[model samples]
Target: MSKRKIHATDIFNLISLTDPQWDKHSRKFAFVQTTMHEEDNEYRSAVYIGDLEGKTIPFTTGKGRATSPRWSPDGSKLAFVSNRNEKSQIYVMPANGGEAEQVTFCKNGARGPVWSPCGTKILFSTSVEGVQDLQQDEEEKKKKKHPEPLVVEKMRYKSDAKGFLDEKNDHLALLDLKTKEISLLTDGDRDYGTPAWSPDGKSIAFVTNLEENPDVSLVSDVYVMDLETKEKKKITNSNGFYSALTFSPDGQYLGFLGHEKEFQSATLSRVWVTKLESGETHCLSENLDVEIGDVAIGDFHSGNVNPGLMWTEDSEGFYFLMSDQGGTGIYFGSLDGAMYPIHLPDEHVYAVSMLTGTHEAIVGVSNSTDPGELYHFDLKSQTRNQLTNVNESWKNEVELCKAEPIQFKAKDGWELHGWIMKPAGFEEGKKYPTILEVHGGPHAMYANTYFHEFQTLTAQGFVVLFTNPRGSHGYGQHFVDAVRGDYGGKDYLDVMSAMDYALESFDFIDENKLGITGGSYGGFMTNWVVGHTNRFKAAVTQRSISNWLSFYGVSDIGYYFSEWEVQGNMEDKVEKLWEHSPIKYVSNIQTPLLILHGEKDYRCPVEQAEQLFIALKKQGKTTKLVRFPEANHELSRSGDLALRIHRLNHVKNWFVEYLQKA
Candidate 1:
């Protein structure tokens, strides 16, 4: 097939494949497929079921989203959630073939369903309206007037997507199949998540933050409730982050992904197991030293539930995924604390499903060239077979850059890893302008996954480069925590060192015409780079942090994120915060900069971008600000479809004006 240049518009055509679940008795596999609707800027999801060797067909079809498909205990019914109406509601149908019926009708709607072991009832999570709020709403409806003002008293008032939280918490509800009645379970002024039913069906395990001030304390514990007695037993302390909870088939052990806050926000999620008899809890992956969650960040997939711990039928060992060195791989962990990685290099295993009896697995993985697709993996043989060709159109049409791995030593003697992507069409004698891209999280890695923005830049004849500097996951504990309190120190040199290695080792890269860009922490680095050096001609900072001092007071994480990562607090460490802030060095910036921000972003609030843009503009330095409405920290990854393309255009044009030849 002849190669063609890819565009940002192609983003809509991509179908995100995720949440593969297997029906053991029926031998049918179901997964969620989502595609973007450009006009309305909405992503529509549908559920699909396929056999091992038969054709794949859509089980539910609609313009609305239908996701999180799960087969019942008997394999006779499929349960899922759909947003066919305003809010997402639970729905179920026969697993083999039948019309899906909406199961729950609620004001806030229900999602994330878990079926009972006997398959007679289903349980899901839904937000509960406070008694006062519900009465106020009713009064307002009767009066045919505007709603009354929301008087919220919580520490955290507004969230990113849900908007003004206003005294609402997600609680559990149990639904009866025969009576079609719902029983509210675990109701309080707290949020619950990830419900799991024990094999005996007498108990339900869930996670909740029952603290007086949940947003401030940020403590969640695992709890198991007796179905008949309604007695709850708390299994964890109020110390750290814990989620992805599951119970073994034998109901003898509890498995979950959590960290003890020993490392604060930089702590990697470890697989923890608790023996029900002894009440002894220990980390299985403590020695493995890798993040135990999805670390591959990309734009294609959204609305993913944690795969958690998938136990074998015998309950001897369990299968789980771990992130290491820019890729996610399935690993087998024994009860004896032995762990071994099932090597899946150069791929992001975003989701995985398995059959109970055998070493059979189906994984949703995406690489540099592929968007996302499911693969039939043989755990015994450690081989994977392609199960779906969902991205064939883009694969056949685009001439994408293949990433080559590179390693270099920082000036401080620390070894760093990175990848280089040459432009689509490369020639020996030509020099191409290069972009040094940085990823967010500061704790996240730049993986070998398909990045649409990078692909478009390569299509525009620019060599794109990225690296996992210190403070990035995939590396060990120390490396991922190195940037704490030393933001602009060695980590700054690590990225610049990658740039130096790229210019020295790759002859096609033009050192004189370089550009830099990043979002969140990456944006902070972009601002830092342009201020410290004039090597880059242009830069773009998106959803970025400019001043740690102001950020510590304004951002949603302002309360503690600064203290955790920047080692700064508003009351105690103001001076240190200002010292590492990029805004402090803005006067020395020589590179023309473009500031992109999401107005609704609470994490790295738009005020951060505003301060930087205002500072650069007042200094008479060349700078521009591009703001997207109703967008949050996830703007680049999964924002409004139209605005995503617009943001990409702004980025492309800024670099085109400065880096590309006339």
Candidate 2:
């Protein structure tokens, strides 16, 4: 660890290795554990059991990664995936933990290993195998493939880098452990993802996007195939994306995540269970309105995503987490659609997944003053048992800030949730300048988890206040939908209301010195807030959206997202897009502004920053532009350590210069 102060940014490859598959039945016991070591950019495997504790397994090669270690039903072998050879391929190892054997040899790569009920076959996905099989003998057969004299195309989707494009798709496949035969499961002009095996092992259920006009990024419906006859059938027929599937012990009903294409003008996802035989589906949870907060969900959440369904063994119901009570606590919900809070005994939980054969769950936790710790949560006793203490090195070297939960009523007579962190060296009765930090994703929420940027701001002698406004997740669906097609409207009022409530209730905040900053949606709000009011002495917008029109064509997901966000596309609602754009109201901005952007960002694109920089410069307004090379939209959350530090330092320097009292 470097001398730099520990913040969330300093941590690398933070992940959970819950209930690693153990082969204790064998004399030479072996278990697989997952770890995030910077030495390897991605997660790698380590075998632990008996004397060979926490040893890196050599079954994988290169810097590419492997994870989600699972044992065959009988514990005779281990199955996992590795990208060491440039493509993720399945590999199996003996329970004694000797040399591993390569099991999958598909050209497109295999993923999501599910052992057959009897452990004789493994099901996975192969990218080009499906499409290749369907292209006909002359078209797909490399030897017989015909070449067409195609004309050169004009420049399209070209920018600073990644000049052109090509056709890409992924499909599902299955492998026979006995004969080592690989068979294509789903084929044709679409993509298939997230394959899960039924409990009986007679059928394999996988999701596929089979629509002729398919949205490339959207998910697919659940489809099943008979193992004996190779006969296939569709389980659910719905337009929305469906994934992250699991068999509810009995296999009578299949649980999966159902994502609506459009909800409040944004992607709406939740847990749903589809009865296999009846073809009936039921929404598992109330809309909750907030996006899933657990870290294990990655970009997908709901049914069996992360902290995957901790079955009760009786199969009455399984437990999964959702963003609730303003994204602060992880609550447990069941298929019955009832929810209850799981107290981690003062620990801030980011993820909760069950360890197989254990009543206790492996949880990812971190608090305002504590680095992340993986602990075990006992269900029956409601007691949390401490597991691995990984952040020991920083116990003495880092300064951690404690966040105090604060709640105040917004002007609309409804209670709003927020948290405040005092400066590290705070002096009693002394007023300090404050920074009102806003979270982006107007649809996203700021949870009570560990945040380095907020802690760093407090260390720099600034009080930090952040909250979940109307459109933030963790709140119910109504609260999340409150900001639909209404940018800078009620959401802006809610933020200002939070600041007003803070000033009136907290006497330690300096009234004359206030600063604000955020990235993405937060950036959009920062731009909108400063333009709408000069209350903030300084403002910084990172990877923000200033002009809506320019963003529609430039950003990668702009076309679909803009239409969803603004409720209309450029072709249909030009006036509404411009009306809500921050740049349109630039003349009203008086506060000094700092614009930060990443060069290779395709989500928000660098040109969005360029437009703001040029417009502000033309107006001779106090402004500065900072760009990160080779960085993308997630520069702050998942960017390189050096770049993340520089970004943090830049924000602190900008605020200190403008808000610090002389």
Candidate 3:
């Protein structure tokens, strides 16, 4: 279509569609489309409405970002979260569009708005300062001085993005539309969130860690409170990780997505329906052998939340996106536990909403070649209709490479799946430098989705190879959990086997000029690869974990994740941690490595990169560490726009230089 390949900086021109909500009458849908502002260093989001005929209209034009749109019961009003007034709070406005009225003014602001069926009240969640902290802040404001020191009392005092949580805790609150007043329905020492109102409006179901030693267990349960009695009772009675609580329209069942910790964090999330009368839970897709929800790993759409369990109009079934092998598609699940397939290939459905009246759905689908766009699928006719061409003009202006799927076998004869992107505007019989990229989450899947980094390499005349190794989602539970307690085991070989297959099968690859790069868990593997083999002439590891002993105590999920995956606590199994650590095998490395890390990346921490750099330096090995200031672990996805572009340039420059030199 054009004479030019897609530039790496084209990521800025892409728009991300998320949180699609259907109106009550099913005549239209409201959703959020986000775009990045380089100078402002923020993602600007706005709500929009579209009809069944693909006609679109903007619903809100706030200067700041907005999201989480919820249509009112009668479809006359729409409520959403916006930061236009200096804080994220709930706002209600006419469904057709008009001036919005702010509903909640809590100190910490409000979000996650859920409308009641009666339209008399709105339910939302907000964080509030503790009693002592509130008093201290008030006193400081009176004296016109800054606040005092931060006192930490919990094991988890800080997080990766919202660092240093201080003492504020999220709690459920209710807003009365008639009086414009807000009241606290539930509050205590612990936090409460993900509130869903009962069908009859007599009860409210919410999630919390009210268990003993909430910090140690890392488990959440659904609790329903009787509005009249002000009493709450737990429905789920197991040590399972649960969220996305939705009560079936008939009010007889509570539907959710959860796993019983059989395989811990690596366990495939299955769909479950709980009987409200009997307290019985049935896993609808237990034998489906695929993980529910979109596990499509990529760098384009940042800050997207899963809108779990979109129920059908009749409430007899549900529609959800399932990650399988390398593709993610939408599937239907019924109340009787029967599943049906609605086929769409090579597309990742990240965010979706259904219009029940017409037996159709509005889906946000994307693939390797496409950034993403909204589509309406007719269930009765089994056909897809394009609703928005958000990236059509940009796509026509540039040439993008399409991914070709490949299958290979590991050393143990395990089948592995991967995709290779030939260099953009390829010429037959001409060899090109190859680059191997690994995804971060050992449990996350590398789906057939848009990957800006991979495309960037293809634009650089490099064939990109990416695989869903063992421990990656989109496979069965056993396959996904196979990497646990064996970090550098078959998972590492699976990736290597993928590369072996590519080099052996594709004659257009220059194996001698190979390079490797990854971040997070993938970064750990990149370090492992350099230490074990000298095949790659250069390597780049980003936000990597070099030592498990320090990772256990420093990371946000380190303490528990280390014990669950590594199979033992850091203190009890010091030898195992060091034995599998890449730092321990640093002497075998010969490739020139580049360490990229965010200074504020608390998930892996900059210290991990520092330790690996110092180890390579002490051994007189070639390495360089580049630190990004004020960036977190999500630098590649939703950090400062300038930093994101620069990071990609750094990676591209490193590979180009080393591959050419080799």
Candidate 4:
């Protein structure tokens, strides 16, 4: 049978595998398998166990979403977070397969369960609002028929993901298995997360911003707490953002991934190991130019927990994920500050679980065509064996396009990386209308990952070209930080240069019927691109930024993000912000633009799209705005299934309407 061409709605049929966890003593490993419930317009996930021999089976089942699977120290019990009830709570079951038991009944909810070294306790995070009991909190919430007036006081009062901020703050709690008692380990207005237990179980290391006004600062420090004395010591000074806390096997060093805000968000996160005895800190990946965590942006995967510092049994070295040259790979780092690649394949390794005392690991790998799957990887041999085919059925039914990697020089002679996907069922000597796709983040790389949007566009007979420009990660620190203060300057030239290189090098591309699209930072670029030049015939901007002046006050991270990226703020560089804003050049746009945005997006809020659409319509230039209700900035990635489909269809239809036909 002939395979069918991929469609925008094909996302519903694909499965995502993430958060792989290996049982220390056994060869078996468990991973979270997520699939879209099309009928319900929701995603359902369950934990599945897979062995090195390639056999896989579900460990958790029935309806509600389950995620963050973690094995106990003895590998006898499995702990995970599920939403089978009204609120998501922790569930623990025997690793050998039996009935699972709900472990926590926190009033707000509980998640991110970390099994204690002794297996006698579990460390989890939950939101708390003071000394109120669960019953009282529920009763108090029920009494309020309507939500009370949200009196916003702090600058960080809302988030694109969590919505409006409440009085409750996320705090760490300790659950005693034998006594069935739960105790709050840390409390107050400050939020805490990413908890790691020492091998001896006497102390816990977690990440938090203890600043009095943490809403204004971006610094997150790592803190270690003594369980017996409840004494807390700050390991990192208030200098940068830090997370992914893990204790070495020997309990002598606390390893983590962080940056010193040298380049703000564009700074490469290095591997830092702090000696507990002398308080000496060392950056293991200081010499490496690649980003220390997974920065490959894709739309298919869900709940992809980065395997930060997976230390070996000897504690001399650890494994980590690094993004370099448009791909994410596994690398090893030693205490003496040496780094080496373990498996640097031309694919995306989203999650990994290394077996103790061995070089073998269960890694979740994905590429341009494959959605994602679990693989038993041998780090020493640098070989991988497929262990699970979660998206096999979808792959068999649909014909996917593979992206061919391309390298070219930017306008200023700097080398850049990107990929081009040929239109589905391409014929020789026939020129195809091409769409230049720009990824968001401006700091995130467009790597060799399964991007549903790219496939859908290619299936619609449009060549998709995506690239990592100056602001993108995986490149050196200087390249990543190049676009910080020069938003539409060199970054714009880089993308335009990519299009120029593609048109000059490839005979199959139709330069006249060109189109452009992007979201978030990419959206901002799309707007900027159209306003600056009429090179493209069509454009689609999603969750974009238009005016830096208004963006600094409206967006959730706008105040700081604008200050960091635009190098200006309302206070000192007001004129500079306007000069860099795309809205300032609205009258120059000639391309027919489609403005797509989430109604509830706080990152590049809907108003950004609204401002652009109104300006275009007032000028009598072709433009349309489509907003997805109840959606946020993540509409393209992890939003509602129906909304995500609608978003893809809107983008595909817009490009097809302007770029295709006679």
Candidate 5:
């Protein structure tokens, strides 16, 4: 049988695999597998176990979603979070296969379960509203009365993902498995997360901001608490952002990933290790040019976990994920600030789990043609053995396009990296319309990964061109931070140069029928591009920013993001902000444009789209606006499956109408 070309709706048939974990004995792997449920309009997830021989089976079953699978120290049990009861809670089940047991019954719910070193207790996090712990029945009864008004006082009162925030704060709690008692460990008005237990189980390390006003501060300090005396000591100096806490096997050092806000959000994250006894800290990746965490952006995978700083058994060195050039790879870093590559293949390593004492690991990887899967990798030999074929059937039935790596120089002779995907079933002598796709995070990299939208466009007879501009990661700190104060300056030249390079290098691209699209930061760039140039025939901007003056107060991160990114704010630099806005040059836009946005989007906000649409319409320009209800900023990635499909179709039809039709 012949294979069929991939389509936008084919996303429903594709499977996503993530968060692979190795058992204590390293005999089996537990990972999360998710698939689209068209009837329910949701994604169904379950935990599955597999061995080195490629034998895999479901560990958690039923309708509810399961994720964050972690094996106990003895390898006899597995702990995971599930929403089987309509509320997320921790559950435990035998590793060999048996019925799962519910462990927590908190009023608001719980998640992120971490087993103690002795395996006798489990540490989890839950949201606490106040000092009183209201009974579930009483809470439901009160909810049946009147709706309470939300009082907003802080700048961080709302978020794009969680929506409006309340007085509740995230706190840690301990569950005694033998006694069946739950005790709240930490409390207050501050939020706490990313907890790690010491080897002896006497101390707990967590991340939180203890500043007088945490709402305005972007600092996340690591603190250690002594369980016996309830004493706390801060590790970080409250200067930067820190996360992914891990203690060395020998309990001598603590490792984490962070940056000192040198370039604000565009700063490269580096690995740091602190001596526990002497309170000395050293950066292990300070001299390395690459960022020390996974910054590759993709729209297909869900529930992906980045296991940072997997320490070796001897505690002399550790393995971590780093973004360099155009890919995310595995690297080993020592305590003395030396780095070495363990595996630097041109593929995206989204998740990884190290087998404590050996040079072996289980990783979840994906490429341009494959969605994702798990593999057993050897550090010494750098060889990978297939462990699961979850997406094998889907891969065999569809024809996908492969991204060809392209490198070129910017207008100033600076090097740039990107990829170009030819249309599926391409012929040498034929011409094809090309679409320039921009990524959302000017700080995130466009790596070699399976992108559903790119494949769908190629299958529809359009070539796709995507590149890492100056602000993109994996290209060192100086390159990534170059676009901080200059949103449309040289960064604009870098992308324009990429399109120029593509037209000059490839003979099949039709320059007259060009189109462009992007979301978030990419969306902002797309708006900027169409305003400045009329070379493209069509354009689609998703969740994009149009006016910096309005964006400063409307966006969730705008109050600071505007200042950190564009180097202008509404208060003192109103003129500068308006000067850099796309609305300033709206009269120059001659291309037919389509605007797509989520009604509930707070990151870029729907008002941004509304403003741009009104400006273009007022000027008698050709444009259309389509908004997805109940969708947020993540509409293209983790939003409702139906809406995601609708969004893909809208983007495809807009370009087809302008470029392919007369």
Candidate 6:
């Protein structure tokens, strides 16, 4: 009898993947429960709400992928978005789980439903039929002899996905509860999203990226609008990217997240608070090295532009999350700006929503060892109570590795921070092959978080080392800003130092054999590392920047990011960009390099991989390029589940084929 080949589906089932949500009152919780079938294509899921007894009762599930569950103001109902009818639409259900009623019967779609404070209106942004309208309006204007809009030719006039988009815009809309009247908030050729409400329900706060010249140097600024008067006001004026806006409980102060034009990595977002009355602003978390990643930001590094900062009903202090010490955790910062930890310092906490009439917050807690779980943490008593157990069955079956935080001195004597994952079934004396994994943002950090890739690598008998180099976030602003115009310089040294430390400290790590891999910025680094040194036997670069010159013209934010990082525009510094291009050094690369890219990725398009591959192949260096069909830059994150598994498997195979004993 032949043994059945273990597939990614098998591994996925062996591990748990749950996305949980907390209610406004924290009395009930809703999360997606996934059950994979071994033989069938269909996957089953349910939206469940847990009661005080820790028992989760099923709420609704008939057809679609239901998620983003938000409780109504009174907690009598739950509003969620589902793709049941082949498209995503808002749906409401009773808290106890019964019949679900559909809302928002629109032609295009609806998403991100948030109920009003009075429980009367639900606010969400929908893509209107504006393109046709804009074209018609342009025709009418042309008939009336109006001037034509400027036709400035750019490299991205035709994108990889949109394919020749002359006019592009995203608007905001609101749905009235009783009348069911939909009102368009702002009509313009720009992108506006992340709508938030004020405490008194008098106004709405949102972020808008005004399309200036199509250079992708978008101005994402915070704006405010009076709900009754329809008066709009731009609150932030600096040349910085501002997002994640929220109002204080008393409605006197507004908080937002922003980063200057120089630091465009999305990994150095700093918290800014503005007094609504005086219009004066102060940087609250300026010194902390953290990136605010969001779904709107597309799961990059959404720190809390507006973290769980529920102001005390009295508005004395606000809650926020700081990801500095090790992991992302919720903390309480006073109105005077003094900050302190709310939960125990040992655990990593996030997604904190306040429970009314209590000194506690319902937060999401996980650790280097455990997957995420909702915990009710009391600031007054300093006690944590677990609320939901989404993955009870996989609790013991899961192989959670210990992330031993390590600090080493760079060759320049600057101290650097990193974390190492020992091989699964690790013994202090046994030798194991190692994989040096680098994070993408170059601005991002590999903190003490539970990552599937790290754990799976450990499970396969590999020690993994990931570090926060000089360019990585969660240090200080200076450390993050230090990477500007210094790519492949000191930051590279920081990573090299981390690997050196890992090789020396871990007796179980085999120094003779090693593998290297990274995505995006990490990918660029991997390409650079392989070209610069032959220490690693194998390397995989995912969604990376190879030729900086091509990337400047090809990527969505390439024009802006190149200017920000390289500190030079495309026209001004062609030689400098080429010098920073990883492909330039491919002649020296001897390691077996595997390049993974997405076909429709506009951010770091397939051309990047092509440039590196052609360079290496011409030089007789071993190389392979795997392109995922119909995938975007976020292949590892929001790509199809099966595709993500395929990507991981391919990476594992590439590494094992080159590094593992033959």
Give each model a TM-score: 0.97, 0.84, 0.96, 0.98, 0.98, 0.89
Root-mean-square deviation of Cα positions for candidate 2 versus the true structure, in angstroms: 5.4
Over the stretch 614-642, how does candidate 3's per-residue lDDT look in tens digits? 98999899888999999999999888888
Q: lDDT tens string, model 2, 471-527?
A: 776666677777878888888888999899889989999988999988898899999
Error of 1 at 97 (Å): 2.5
lDDT of 5 by residue, 1-662 (tens): 87789989898898888888888575888999998887888788999999899988999888869998988989999999999987788999999888899998777778899999999999999988753542145456466566889998899988997888888888998899999788888888888999999998999899999899876887999998999888998988988999999999888888999988999999999998989999998887878888998889999997777687899899998999998888888999888778988888899988888885778989889999998888999888878898878788988998889999999999999999999999989999999999999998889999989999999999999999999999999999999999988998999999899999999999999989999999988888999999999989999999999999899998899999999999998778888788889989999888999999999999999999999999999999999999999999998999988999999999999999999993
lDDT of 6 by residue, 1-662 (tens): 22222233443553222445556554666655554444543445556776556677767767446766778877888888777876577888878667888777654567777788898888886665563431123345446565766575665565544534565545666777787776777777666788888878888988885546535555777888898888887787646777667778778988877776655663467667888888888877654445543211112111222343556667767666666645666656666777665643544554566653476666665566665666667778778777766554564555557888888889999878878888766787688888998888766666665566766677777788888888776666678788789889988888899888887777788887899999999999998898899899999899899988888878877876887787666676888888888888878899999999998888888999888888888888888999999888777754656777788788888877887864
* Model 4 / residue 20 / CA error / Å: 0.5
Clashing pairs in 6: 289-474, 292-301, 292-302, 292-303, 293-301, 293-302, 293-303, 294-302
How would you encode candidate 1's per-residue C-alpha lDDT over 1-662 as one tens digit per residue?
56988888889878888899998898779999888887887888899997777468999997988998989998999999999977788999998787889888776778898998889899888888653321114344456566889886654776667666766788888899889878888776678888888888888888888877776787778888999999998888888889888888899988999888888888888998988778888888888888888887676678766778889888888988888888888888989999988765777888888874787888888888888888888888878788888888768887878878888899988989988999988899899999999988888888878899999899999999999999999988988989998998888999999999998898898878899999899999999999899999999998899999888767777777888888977776789999999999989998999999998998888999888988999999999999899888888877788889998888888999999853
RMSD of each: 2.0, 5.4, 2.1, 1.3, 1.3, 5.2
Model 6 Cα displacement at 213 (Å)? Answer: 4.3
The worst-scoring run of ten residues by lDDT in candidate 6 lies at 295-304
What pairs collide in candidate 4?
none
Question: Candidate 5 versus the native: TM-score?
Answer: 0.98
Clashing pairs in 1: none
Local distance difference test scores for all models? 0.86, 0.68, 0.85, 0.90, 0.90, 0.71
Model 6 regions more than 4 Å off: 1-11, 14-26, 32-46, 131-168, 210-217, 262-267, 287-308, 344-347
Model 3 bad stretches (over 4 Å): 130-147
Mark the regions of model 1 whose C-alpha exceeds 4 Å error after superposition: 130-152
Better of 1 and 6 by TM-score: 1
